[model samples]
Target chain A: MMFYINQTSCISPQEFILFDDNHILRKATGGKLFALEPNYKNIPSAQLRRMGKAVRFGVGAALPLLQQGNDVNGIIIGTANGGMEDCMKFLKQIIEFDEDSLTPGNFVQGVPNAVASQLGLLSHNLGYNITNVHRGLAFENSIIDALMLLNEHPLNTYLLGAVDEISDFNYKIELLNGNYKQQSNEGTDFYESGSQGSLAGEGASMFFVSNKKDAAIAKLEFVETIHSSDEEEILNWVEGRLGSHLIEMDKIDLLLTGENGDNRVLKYYTAIESIFNNKISIARYKHLCGEYATASAYAVWLICELFKNSKVPLHIMKVGTPPQKIEKVLLYTNYLGEQHSLMLFSKVK
Target chain B: MTAIVVTGLGIISSIGNSAEENRESLIKSRAGISKNNNFYSRYSTLLPFGEIKKSTAQLMEELNANEKGVTRTSLLALHSIQEAIEDSKLTLNQISSSDTALIGASTVGGMCLTDQLFIDATTASKGSEYLSSYDCASVMLYLQNRYKMKGIVNTINTACSSSSNAIMCGARLIKSGLVKRAIVGGSDSLSKFSINGFNALHILSSDICRPFDANRSGLNLGEGAAFLILEKEEDCKGKKVYAKLSGYANTNDSFHPSSLSEDGQGPFLAMTQAIESASLDASSISFINAHGTATENNDEVESVAMRRIFEKVPAFASTKSYTGHTLGAAGAIESIFSVFNIINQEVYSSLNYTSPIEKTGLVPNLNYRKTSVQHVMSNSFGFGGNCSSLIFSKH
Candidate 1:
C-alpha cells in the first residue's frame, strides 16, 4: 500500500514553499545562494529558544505544514552531520580535559537520532521515532520507512524529514575539494547553461505523509537504493522500473539529477541526460541548494511541487517549456560512492 | 501477504555475552551495571553505569579480532554479527555477494576511537587512518570490506531505537521481496562521550537505575551490541525460529526535541500500531519489556504510555536496570533479551528498586517471575522524540 504526501516544507537556498502545495521553483534568492532561515520566533519563542540551528530549521519547516489536527504517527529524520558542532566541541573537551573533566550535554545531543528525539520531546509525541544517517540515502530510506510504516499501519501518519548543516570542518573540505561552485558573472539576466560546480548549501526538508490521499498532493511511486555504482545495473533498473508502469519513459516530463555543478557529477548527469535526451525536462538543483549528502531530499520535494503547481522556478531550470500538467518525476542521487538512490513520483490529480 | 520471521540472534551486553548467558542473568535478576570501570570520569561520584567490566583491549582478545581497530564497540558487534550470521546458517561468502546484505550498524560508532582519532588527526600519520572510522556508516563499509558481504551494506543510527530500526528495515526488505536476507542490529560501546553526555543532563543515576520505581534516580549508561538474522521464510524453513517478530512501529513526538510528550502519546501510538501489526490484542502480550531508562521523565512517560494502552498492562520490567542503557544497542540488545525471556518463560527483575512511581504505580518485575508467555512487547524511546516498540511472539 502506497502512502500519500499530505503536506511538505523545505528550507533551502530557494524561497520556502509547502512541498506539495506548490510546483515549479525559480532561483528566487538572486542566485546569491544562502541557507533559507525560517521565522521560528513566530510560532512560539520558547520552542525556538533551546533549538540549535538544526532543530529550528527542521521544525520551522515541517511543524507548520503538518498541523493536521493530530500528532503524526511518527517522526522520521535523517541528518548527515547531526549537531556535529556539539559533538566536535565535546570531542575537543574530551581531548583537552582527558575524558574525566567533561559533561554529557553536548554528547547527548550528538547522536544522529537526537534531532528527531528533540522534536518528539517538544511535540509531546512518544510514538515510533527514528533518525537514519546513510548520507543522501538517509532521506530516501527515511521515506521508505515512512511509506512502509503507513502500509503496515494505515492511520499512522508520519513526518519524514532530513536536515544537513554546514560545519566549518566539512564546509572547508568541500571548498578545497572544488565541489563548491559560486559563479563570477553578472546576475543571470537568465541564460540557461549547465555549470561545473556550485556552492555547498544545507537545509532541512520534511513531508507530512499519510494514508489519507484526499489531502495528499502526490503519491510516492517507487524508491530504490543501491550501493554499487555499476551504471549498467542502474540503467537497466531504471528502464526496468519504467517498463512496469502503464506509461513509458517517453511519458516522463521532468528528470532531476543531483549535480552540484561538479564537472564529474555534471558528467554523470550528462550521461543520464544523454539517455533521456530532449524528451524530458532535466533540472539540476545543486545550483539552487548546493550539495549535501541528502540534497536530493529537496529534489524530491521540488518535483512533487512542480507536478502540483505546473511550473518550474527559474532558479532550478536548464531549459524546456513548462508542462501544463505533470504526471511523473524521477529523483536520482549518490553520496560518497556508496549509496545511489532513485525515487519515482506520480502526480495524484 | 508476507510474514517476518526472526531466525537467529546474537548479543554481547553487560548482562550476558550470548543469548543463553543473557537469559540466565536476567532470570537470576543479576545486574550487569556497576560504577564506570574503564573510563576515568570526573562524575564518578554522581554517575554509575552499566559499563562492561572488561577493558576494550581484553574484549578484542576475547573476540580474537585485535586487528579490527578494536573499539570495544566494534568488537562487541563482531561477536554478535558473527553469532547471528552463523545462527542464520548463511555465510556472506556463500550468499553470492550479489544479494543485498543490509546491516544497520548504528551508534555514534567509534566515538571511543574518536577521542584518540581527534588527538591523532593533528598528531600522527597513523591517526589519519582512523578518520574513516569516525562516520557511523563507515562501520558497515568496514564490516562489508572485512567480511566481503556481497549484499547491500548500510548503517542506521537511530539512537536507542538504532538497532530496532535496523531490524525493522531488514525485515521490511525481506517482506517486500527487495532482498533475500539481511544481518541487522546495533553496536555501541561506552565512552566518556556518552557517559558524560547523560551525566550533564543529570539523567545518570548515582547507583544502578531503578526503572518504574518512585525512588528511581536515573539511567546507568551502558554499552554493548546485538543483532539478528532476518531471512525470507522460504529460506528459513528448517531453521529454529526463536520468535516471530509480529509487529514493529516507530513514531516521533513532535512535542519536544528532547523529552517525550506529556501523555507519552508518541509511544502509546507506536505500541498501538505495533500491536495491531501483529494482529493481536493487547491481552496477548504476556509480558512487556519497557525501555525504562529509569530516568524520571522516561519512567513516568513510558509507564503512562503503557497504561493508556494495556487494560491490564501485563507484568513488565526494564532490563536496563541490569544492562544499563546501551544507547544505540538498546533496541537489539533488549529485543534479544525479550526473545530470551519468551523462550524461557520468565521475566527478569528490575534490579535496585525501592518503590514504585506515584503516577502510574507501575512497578517493574524486580523479582524473577515465570509465566507461560506467548508474546512479548518491547519498547525503546530516545532523544529527538524517537520512539519504537516491537512485538516478539513464541513460535
Candidate 2:
C-alpha cells in the first residue's frame, strides 16, 4: 500500500514557507532557533493566544497544508515535547503567583494533545484525530498511524507531523550537564570549524498524506525505525532492511545519517561510510538544522526536496554522489543510538 | 478480513506484578490501591492511591539492572515486556532485526525524575543530572537502545488511550507485513503534575474508584505497565494461543479536552467499528473491560455507548475499580484483564457498586460470576477525545 503527499508544510529556523522554498539550507543561530516562517497571527487569533511554542509551530506547520486537504479523513500530529513548554510555564506561574489562582490557558494548552484538539476545533475535520507523543518516535508513530488509516480505508489525506521546542530550562539543564558549552555567542555556528556542539532547533513538519495520487510530488514507499544496540548493529540492520527490499548494499544512492557531530553517534554512522564505498552519498542535517530528538523529521523534509530537485545542497551533503537515477533513496537516522529511523522513497511516476 | 492475533501476554499492576498473581487478585477481589510512600508532599497524605507497593530499589534488584534513574514507568515497561517476550517463546536474538519491532507507550517518560528536578528548577539554572528524562521521547529511545531491536521503537501518547493505540498499531504492523512480531505495551508512573492536574479538574476520588455506580464520584489514579507480544498467524501456528486480537478501532470525540461528548459518540464509533472489524456479531462479546472512569460524565457516555452498540449488554465491569486509571498503561493492562476472561471464563465484579446510573439504566455486575467467556471487549478513552476499543477472543 502507498500514500501520497497531497500537501506538506514545515516550520524551521529558516524561512516559514513550505519545503518548496527557493532558499536552500538557510542558516539559523541565536539563543534559541525558531521557524523563520511561523505566522502565528495567520493561523489563529488572540482568543487562543496562550499556546506555547510547540502549539504555534504545530499550527503553523499544519494549517496551510490542511486547507488544501480540508476533506482529509484524519489528523495525526506527533510531538516530542507536547505541552512541556506550557507545563513549565504554568508551574512557574503557580510558583510565582503564590497559588492564589491558576490560569486555564496554560493548563489547557499543557495537555499533550492540545495541538490536535486545537486542530479539530480549527479545521472542524472531525473524521479522526490522534496525537502521538513519544520522544524521538513521535513522528514515526504518527506516520505509522496514518499508514494504518490509509490501509483500512485509503483516507484521501492525513495531516502527519512532529514538533518539539526547547525552553530556558532546556538550555539551563544542558549547560549544567555540559551538553551546552559556556560563553557561546548568538552568531555561533553550531557545526563550524571550531564549533564544539550542535545548537538546539525546534519546529514542526506536517504532511498532507493522501491516496488519490493526483499531481503527486512523492509517494511514501516504506518507512521504518529501530532502537539500535550499538554502532555495528545499526549498520547491519540498515543493510538487512535494504536486502529485504531486494536492494543491494552498493545500490543505495543516498544515505542520510542523523549525525550531530557527536563523536560517539557520528562514529556509528561512520563505520558504514566505507561500506557504502563513497558510492553512496552520505548527508547530515544537524549541521544545517541543529540536533534534537526529532531532527530526523527535518532531515526527511530535506531529502524530499532533494528527490524533487536533483541538486543537493553542498553545505549539508557530507559525501558526494550525484542523483544519477534518483530511483531509491534510503534515509537513516539514530537518536542517541536509542531509536533509529529509516525511510525509503523513490521518485514516483 | 485481516486477523491480528495476540500470541502472548504480560502485565504488572499494583494488584499483581505477574499474570498469575493478577488472576488470583481478580478472583479474590483484592485491590492494590493504597497510600503513597514518599514524604515528598502533603498531597500524599490527602490522597490514597493505587500505588505499586514495590520500591525502586526492589525493582532494580529484581531486574539486576545497573543503570539508575530508570523511572517506575520504565521499570514497569521492562517487567511486563520481559514476561511478554518470554511468553511468546520467540527468541529475541534469533529473529532478524528487521522482523522485530518494539512499540512502547508512556504519557510521561521520566517525569518520576521531576521530583528531583523540582528542587533545582527554582534554585539553580538546571535540574538534576538527568535532564534527559524530562523529555518523554528520550526515555522511550532509551528503551529502544537497550533492547537493540531494529524494526521500530515507536512511542505513542494519546493521553490515557496511549497504550491501547500502541497495541493497535502493533497489530497493524503485522497485518501490513512491516514486521512478523511486535512488542506492544504502555507504562505511566504517578506524578505531581498528573495528580495535581486531575485534582484541579476535581475528578479525582480520595478513595478507591467505584465505577459505574449511581453515586460514582470520580477516578483513582494508578501506576504500572503491561504488554503483549503479537505475532503473525504463521508465527504461532500450533502454539497455545492465549487470545486472538480479532478487531480493534480508534475514534475521537473531538469534544472537550478532558470530558467526553454528551452523546457518547466517541465510544459509539469505536465499539461499532471494532465489532465490525472483528467480523463478529455483537452477541459474541461476553465481557467488556469498560473505561468507566467513574467521573459523572465518563460512565454515562460509555454505558450509553455500550447499550447502543450491543442489543444485550454483555457482563461489563470497570476493572479500574481494582487498578485505578493506569493512564497510558490502562489499555495494555485491561487487555490482559480481557485475556483473563478468555482464560478463566469468568466475569469479575465492579466493586462497591450499589446502584446503576439512572441516566442510561445500565448496571455493571456487582459480584464475580463464573461463566464461559468467548470474546472480551476493552475500551480506553483518553483526554483528547481519543477513544479506542479492542476485541480479544478465545483462541
Best by lDDT: 2
How does residue A172 of candidate 2 score in lDDT? Answer: 65
User: Candidate 1: interface RMSD in Å?
Assistant: 3.8
10 residues in a row with least lDDT, candidate 1 chain A: A184-193
Please estimate how well model 2 matches the true structure, expressed as its whole-model Cα lDDT: 0.74
Write the residue-wise lDDT of candidate 1 on B19-89 in tens digits.
Answer: 77888888777888666667666654456667667787787777676563445677778888777877777
Candidate 2 residue lDDT tens string, B122-197: 5654456566666555545556656655566677777888888888888888888777788888888877666766
Q: Candidate 2: lDDT of B393?
A: 90
Q: What is the lDDT for A142 in model 2?
A: 81
Clashes of each: 59, 3
User: Which structure among the candidates has the greatest TM-score?
Assistant: 2
C-alpha lDDT of residue B268 in model 2: 92
Global lDDT of each candidate: 0.71, 0.74
Per-residue lDDT, model 2, residue A30, is 55
